[model samples]
Target: MKSLRLYGKQDLRYEEADNPVIENTDDVIVKVKAVGICGSDISRYKKLGPYVEGMVFGHEFAGEVTEVGSGVEGIRPGDRVAACPTFYCGECESCKKGELSRCEKLTVIGARHPGAYAEYVKLPAENILPLPDNVDYDTAAMVEPSSVVAHGFYRTSIKPGAEVAIMGCGSIGLLAVQWAKIFGAKKVYAIDIDDAKLEVAKEVGADVLINSMEKPAHEQIMDHTNGSGVDLAVESAGSPITSAQVFALPKKGGEVVFMGIPYADINIERFYFEKIVRSELTVLGSWNAISSPFPGKEWTSSVHYMSTGQINVKPMISHRLQLSEGPETFDNLINRKGSYVKVLFYPELD
Candidate 1:
C-alpha cells in the first residue's frame, strides 16, 4: 500500500507502507476509491511546524469495504460506503446522548488518525454509511463536506421563506446556498470576492450574488432586504473580515450561524452591543455533525439527496490528479493561483 504522509510544512511525500489490518473489534478496512482535499488541509500544508507532521492528509472519502471485524454487522465486505471523518467511541456519555461528534474519545480521520489519502484506510464500521448505487465515487467522497453544511443548517433552524445570506463562495458556502434553496428559503444571497465562485453560486440557485470587492456586501445585502437585514446569515469564509461582516448583514433579532473555522481571534464587540443588545439576536456555533443525533434518520436522506440529483456535486470538483501531484495541488490551493473549487487525489494510480 501507499500513503501520502506529511513530513513537515509544505512537504508531502508518497511513501510506500503496509496495508492496514483490522486492529479493533469494530474496525473495518476500506480500499479508498476517491478522496477530496479540504481547506484545512491547505492551512496545515503551508504552515511550518510539527503540528501536523506524520499525518495522512485526507478526511472526505468514499470506498469499498475489503474487510470487517467480528463486532461489525449490517455491512458486508463488498459494500460501497462513504466514511464519516469523525470517529466516536459509541460508549461515551455524549455518544449515549446522541452527540457523537462530542464523544469523549472523538478522533477525526486525517487529523488524529491515519486518513483516506492512501490505498487503504482503517475505520470503525459504525462510522461508515452505505453509498447509493446511483452515486459515483467522486460525489460519494463529498458526503462528509455536504453533511457539514446539512448539520449547520440544522443548527440554525432556518425557516422557509426567510431571507438568507451566505458569506464565502467556497465549496461549503456553495453547498449552503443549495441547502437553503432546498429547505425553501425565499431569498438566498451569496457573497464572495471571486467572480468565478459567485458564478457557480448563481448556477446553483443563489437568488442574488454580491461581489464584496466591487461593493460593500453589507450595504448590498441591506438594500436587497429593504434595510431590515437578512433573517439568517451564515459565515463560511473562515476569515476575520468575512466573519465580522456577518454581524452587519443580519437584522436585529436575526440568526447568525458561524460555520467557518477561523484561524485567528475575531473581534465581536459590535455583534455583542449592537446586534445582541438592540435586536436580541441568536448566535450559534456549529461544528461537525453528530451521526447519531436528531436527524439520525436523515443520514440516509442526505445520501438520497445526492443520489437523486437534488444536490449536484459535479460542478464542485475542479481538479483530479494522481497522488504524485498532491503537493502541487496543495500549493495551488493555498496560493489561490488556480481556478478550482475542490481537488481530489487518486492514490491508487502510479
Candidate 2:
C-alpha cells in the first residue's frame, strides 16, 4: 500500500506500507478512496503530536469496504462508507456517563493507530458509517470534519432568528457558517483576513462577510448588528488573536464557543477579556466529534445533511491530489504558497 508517514516535525514521507487486515472479530478493512487533510493534521505535522513513528497519516476519509470479519454484520464488501476515526476508552468516567468525547483516554486514528492515508485501513465495525448513494466519496471524506463543526453547534443554545458570527473563514469556519444556518440563525457573519475564504463562506450561506484585516472583527460584527453584537459567536480560526477577539462578538448574556485549537499561549486583552466578565457570556470549548453512543448524532446528522445538500463541502475543497504528493503538499500548505482551504488526497489516484 502507498501511504504518507510522518517522520518528525515538518517531515512527511510518501512511501509504500503494508496493507491493513482484519485483526479482531469485529474488524473491517476498507479500500482507500478519498481522504482529506485536516487543520489538525497540518498542526501536528508541523509540531509532532501523539503519534506512532511513521504511522499512516490521515483520518478524514471515505472508502469502499473490501472485507469484514465474521462478527461484522449488516456491513459487507462493496459498501461505501465514511468512518469515525475517534477512539475512546469505554471504561473512562466520561464514557461511563455517556460523554464519549470527553473520555479520559480519548484519541484517534492517524495518531497512535494506523490511519486512512493508505491503500487499505482497518477499524472496528462500529466505527464504520455507511454512506448513501447521494453522497459521493469526496463529500463523504469530509464527514468527520463536518461532524466536528456540528458538535460545536450542538453545544450552543442558538434559537431561530438568532444572529451568529463565525470568526474565521477556514474550512471549519465555512462549515460553521452553514451550521449556523442549520441551527436557524437569522443572519450569519463570516469573518477572516482573506477575501478568498470569505467569498467561499458567502457561497456556503454566510449572510455577511467581514475582513478582520480591515478592522477588528468584533468591531465590524458590532456595526452589522447595530452595535449590539450577535446572539452567538464562534471562534474557529484556531488563531491566538481570534481566540480572544471572539469574546467581544457576542452581546451581553450571549454565547461563545471555541472550536479551533490555538496551539500557543493565548493572552486575552483587557477589552476582550472584559466581555466575558461583564457581559456574563456563556463560553464553551468543544472537542472532537464523538458523544454518547460512540460516534453519536454529530456524525449521523453530518452525513444526513450532506446527503440532503445542506452541508456543502464543494467550495471548501481547494485541491485534490494523489497520495504521492503528501510531502510537497504539506510544505506548500504551511509556507502559504497557494490557496488552501481543504486539500483532499485520493489514495487510489494515478
How many residue-pair clashes does candidate 2 contain? 0
- Cα lDDT of model 2 by residue, 218-286, tens digit: 888878878899999999999999999999999999999999998999999999999999999999999
lDDT for each residue of candidate 1 in 1-350, tens digit (9 for 90 to 100): 77888878888777876678988889999889889987777777776433457777688899999999999998889999987778678798988988776778876787778888899998887678898789989989888888888888887877788889999989889888988887779999999999989988998889999999988898998788888998899999998888777888888789888889878878865644486657778888877765575325435656888888878888878888887788777777778787989888777774
Q: lDDT for model 2, please.
A: 0.92
Off by over 4 Å in 2: none
What is the TM-score of candidate 2? 0.99
Q: Distance from true position, residue 147, model 1, in Å?
A: 0.9
Root-mean-square deviation of every model: 2.2, 0.8
Top candidate, metric TM-score: 2
- Residue pairs in clash, model 2: none
List the pairs of residues colliding in candidate 1: none
The alpha-carbon lDDT assigned to residue 275 of candidate 1 equals 64
Against the reference, the lDDT scores of all candidates come to 0.82, 0.92
